[model samples]
Target: MIQETLGHLLPELELDPHTVSALLCASAAAVAALNWMQRRRIQKKMEEARRMRDLGLQCMEKAVQRFKQQNPGADPSRILSLPLVELAEKLKEGSLSAESVLYTYVDKALAVTRELNCLRHVIPECEGQLRDLQGQKEKGLLHGVPVSIKDHIGYKGHLSTCGFAPFLGPPEQENSVLVQVLKHQGAIPFAITNVPQSLFNYDCSNAIFGQTLNPWDHRKSPGGSSGGEGALIAAGGSILGFGSDLGGSIRLPSSFCGLCGLKPTVTGAIGPMAQDVGGLALCMRALLGDALFQLDPTVPPIPFNEKLFCASTPLRIGYYETDGYFLLPPCMRRAVRETGELLQEAGHTVSPAVPTSCSEAASLLSPAAAALQGCIVFMVAQDLVDPGLKPQVNCYRIPVLVKKILALLVRPLVSPSSGQLQVFYGSLPTLSPQAYRTEFIAKWKKLQLDVVLCPVLGPAFTLGYPGKLLAAVSSTMLYNVLDFPAGVVPVTTVTEADEEELLHYRGHYDDAWDRRLRKVRAVGLPVAVQCVALPWQEELCLRFMKEVETLACERKKCT
Candidate 1:
């Protein structure tokens, strides 16, 4: 009977009958072994994660306690507004010393890092740099100012892990172009901030540095891949920091953290060094132009212009509250409205502006760009890589047929809407290339408006949730598609009343969007507004951002 049963199943098996039976038994044993190995790997990873989290927490706690101990009666908010630029000016004028300014910011930065997990390294050599700068004949604009850099941006002799384990410890070389520029400007390189693994996800969490909490609300995310810079800047830990944005890396975090950020048009600001991969230096020099050269030499030689930003009169402002894909959260809506009112009141001609079709533009642009580059995939792969299981290597090593079969069998278990898969499929030749070209040209022409204001995402969702709904990122990426400059400014905080209002929201968009927006309302998250400008419009972007900032400030006064 057993032989008959085996014979009947033989056609269904891949190997010879005897071999198939032995292999089946062995496979069971192997699966058991694999499961055991997976559990062990998971356990180890969890422990490591826990340890890193705890270390970060403890450090923050101690630093905060120290700050309180030092300034028993001081208001934390007062410390938050201590302007680095002003402090540097004072230091240059001989009214303040570099040592005092460095100490104040260093002490405050230490407190912030402990509380927010915003820092990866704090330089003890900050004092040495300050002392060296004190003797300089001509103090630059940032002289004696302490500045922090995101971990991914290189600093000489510092670790440029970009928050990955393989690149941990100190790097062999000195400053990247940006770092060199900052040093040339007389800024003291005091610390390096944390970043998400691979700098992909919006939430600033990783295996190396763990998660960075929002200074405004610890439960909420600070935003990423430049989240650490945002958090540190928001908390007044740094006056200026370097951040890069492919999607919304700079803008999202800045908006979420209630700080100002600029995402220059490609080649606007400089110095992401050419990285050597597999003994080949991948040079991005062709992509570098005037836009990036203004910031660093590692970038092309673009000169900074102060005149383009100086508007002689009130400017024409184009604004929109929602992107049409996702409804703006109440706080964000209010911010846009308030900004319009302020711009109008400030003598600017504020008008309602609508792009032709945000949905079509986003759908056409993002998936193709994201997938072809594997930009977000490698960014998060390090965090997802199982230390013990060797999942990445195993996936690579498996036979193609076996891999396809396994994927087919297992895909049902995973969510169809996962961004990882979406990004993966985005690399395929399935998208109509002509459609992309036509849409890109159309979107570019439609974006002739001076600057656009829109929501970062519908409502203020938590950190982890944004990963799945990355398509909503089109609000920001719409500009990246057009190679435009964009900025993010914090407008308002979520309240119970807003939640009550969102509870009744029934939008005309898809059910997935409705669900995501509803989930966002459940959490009292901060609302942020985004401003977009045409290509090579960093000056205009900053000006529009300042206008919004003024409006936000006025609203605060009114309240």
Candidate 2:
């Protein structure tokens, strides 16, 4: 059949067999050349990445040697264990030199990166920063403290490679406003951490820099786009670090790593993560200072409000165990319950809070929404998309009618009430963005709540599940759309009882995502609850987080 059809077409075109063969040969060679060129380009990027990694490691070695010679028989572990505020106080009081703190963290950061593949590029200029700080008459708040930043945050003469090959171009000419604020406050920006490709997935892995593993367990994910910051800080590589969150990027990783983190009410918001809540407060105080306001005039000219943060007055706090959109795991529900009970014991009015009946808020604010909004342009013309992000991109490229049909077909197979169906069903706008935001804000006002307590998400899933479990983030996503300040505080660890609960787990809808989530070996993982406040109430949010941290610590001692 093929010969007869070709034979007739060839004769009608009046082309000989040799002509057809030649055309086919030319097409094959063209394809081969394109493939060769693409391979060379990626090779060049990898070479540069290695060069940067090696240079940072070499700088680390020199600093560590110098530190040992300067302070003979000093225990690095002792310094490593100190919280951010204590470390800063030591530096200011002259008991610990700025050089000693810098060198100690640099050494630990190197070890953490070696074990977890977290650091994207270590800033060798931290030594210069120390020298400059020493010459100053009045030291700033974060005096001589070493800090790690997300890979996408800008620094002078460094590539802000957001884990994409094509982003490997000329370095940024100057530090971003946030970085400038850190430096002015005497904080040394020492390292940049890894992120998922295009900052698209909650799980951190990209083709260029590879994957970043959890410090608690190598098999599980740390969470992204701030996964590296979470992993590094959890391993005690840095006392304080900064990461941006669009949708649970900062909160999820922080919860997974058993660290405290915040997501402010700003788009592409940059906030701090630390092992203790005090560290977060210090970082927030520094970021909201006069320096930040001057560098970025668009930012509110509000300095850190000490009165609001330190007020002992009780707050009317609302709590929720589930969002009704996605099923909450038993451990997650327990985290919220325990947090509420702790708050009540401390004299706060804690009550249940329910959101309006619209569940599409998270779907509209998710990474998939960013893809449909044209944020993934850098992903085009690449060698390949990471497996975690490929599904969202394909969903974006699918035809509208086809998506509707696919959504219908996927419903029964995944779950009758699975939140994953939103990806396909969201092909058309469901609600006005403004209307959704107003409804949630109205609920908050009606309840007269100063803050809300809820689960950050089911404790970190196994690596590579972030792409599949987008709906699980609904508990955290509502605040993102409302532009409210939200934070995560580690309240408990996954218990033997929690693990037992998982064996009998069937979600509200018995969803496929829940079944897959229950299979994650998270027996010993940390479980945390999210704390949220109204817009511009970051300090209040941090205050609530600190209260949770204090209660959890006391509870642990009693246990």
Candidate 3:
């Protein structure tokens, strides 16, 4: 077959065999040289990454080591051991010195950065921030609190690298609005954390920062793009951390690390964009009043409504295990189910609830996947992407002819519903995400539930496994698709019983990805459930999260 095809093509070219052979040889040589250049480029970036990381280590170590030597009696680890709410109280009472609190967290952050590679940079200006707070009788709400910033959010005089190498040159000229607000609240930005390259993948590896490992078990990935924050908080390196979530970035990391995270359905049309913002940022805007709305006039003039947040009425809770896209593992399903039962026991109504239909959404994933890949390629060169992400870039480069071929090959093997992915992937997706959100909102309103509970990326993926487990994010992604406010709370940890149950697990799907779920053996890792409410219902979302957290504490006590 090969000889016949070549025979026809060679004749059409009207070239001698020798000439054709030489042309092929030259093309191969050119390919090899390009490969070498790519390798060299990656090597150079890796060296730069290590050098920058080492410098951050030096700065962190010097401050932390100095604090340890000066005040030997001061418990360096105690600040991290306390809760964020408690940490704020101590600072408010003037019982804890801001300098010492910053020093303690910096000490832990340095250690965590060494072990988990979770920081982009340790805020070098923390000393100046502490000095300014001294002797102030009226400190802000977060007074003396150490907050870890995601790599993408801007801080004055610091680089917002967002895991891109070319984007790593100069420091930012101004603080992002969120940073300004946090500063107003007396919060100190102590350190910046690592993220996946382009802040796209769930896995935390990137050419610039390498990989941010799960603090509990170094073998697994801490869920990302806010992964570094998650890793830091889980390791007791920071009290409160901030991150962004286009999909499930904050929720996934929090769930993976056994922490709390919120993703508000707050619209940028009504929110401040001067800084990278998320759920809590909206709350800040709400609390700070209309002045913030004036600062960013594009934002909705909505302030934090204390009445909505403090309302303690029981919620009608909806829960589900699968979105009919990615079937979760036994452990994750159990976590959601257990949370539903717990919420019911606490006087909230809980029942099985389906999300705004997956049929339309499933068709959107392929286009969504392509667009996600397209954005990366458009912003970065092939060599600049982490080696792990490069393959994805190539796969999404599906040409029209290639897409047709792939559709033909794949359609026969998968379910009729999943086949829509081929059609969506081959075509261009809507540029503005708001169009789809409009449709999802209509369906969600009909469900009439105040809160919903689901898994956060299926029991924290094994290291390097999240990119392959994209569908597992469907449960969380649906909220992003609907622009709903969502919160993640550590409900339980994966137990020996959970691991045993997984060994015999048979999920709703029987495909390659489902088998991977069955094979995962994540014993002793934290498992969390996501709590969600409709758009502009962030106050209700947090309220349920607090209730869920209370129930989690009770479950821990009884166990």
Evaluated with lDDT, which candidate comes out highest? 2
Native-to-model Cα distance after best TM-score fit, residue 438 in candidate 1, in Å: 9.7
Assess every candidate by TM-score: 0.74, 0.94, 0.87
lDDT of 3 by residue, 1-559 (tens): 5445566787978876667677878999999999888768766866776687688779778878888888888976676666666667788898888888988888888888889988888888888888888856677767877787888788887778767776767879998877777776778888888889888788788877788899888988888778888898788888777788877888888878887787766521112111111234333533355545655665566667668777888888888887766677777788888888888888888888776555445445556656676777876664476765665566656664787677677767767655234443463334236667776666556767788888767466778787665556677666766678887877777889888887876655566667777878778888878888877777777778778777888889998
Q: What lDDT does each candidate get? A: 0.61, 0.83, 0.73
lDDT of 1: 0.61
The list of candidate 3 runs beyond 4 A from truth reads 1-42, 135-138, 267-292, 365-369, 378-385, 419-444
Candidate 1 has which clashing residue pairs, if any?
Answer: 60-114, 60-115, 156-174, 156-175, 198-379, 267-291, 267-292, 268-291, 268-292
Question: Which digits, one per residue and each the tens of the lDDT, describe model 1 over residues 1-559?
Answer: 6555777777666555677678779999998998777656655755664475456445544654675587576544543355544555575687665655565677677778879989877765665686688678976656776777777777766667665554554564866766666666677878788887666566787666678888877877788778788788777787667678877787777767766677767722321110011000001211233423665445336444456555656777777876665565566677688777877887877778766455544545534554433543454333344231132233334444554465466556545432222322231232353565466446545644566777775343465666555555667766665666777776667778877777776643435555666666434555667877766656667667666766776787889
Q: What is the lDDT of candidate 2?
A: 0.83
Tell me the deviation in Å of residue 265 in model 2: 1.1
Tens digit per residue, CA lDDT, model 2, 1-559: 5445566778978777667767878999999999889978886887787687788788778878887897897778888988889998998787888887788888899999999999998888888888898798888888899999999999999889888777888999999999998888888999999998878678898877788999998888999889999999999998899999887889989988999999988866999999988988888888898888888887899988999898879989998888877777789899899889988999999999987643667655643574543556445446456776666566556655676787667666654334556554552346676788777888889999999988888577788888777677777777777788999999888988988988888776566777777776688889999999989999899899888889999999999
Reference-based TM-score, model 2: 0.94
Clash count for candidate 2 is 0
TM-score winner between 2 and 3, please give it. 2
Q: What does the lDDT come to for candidate 3?
A: 0.73
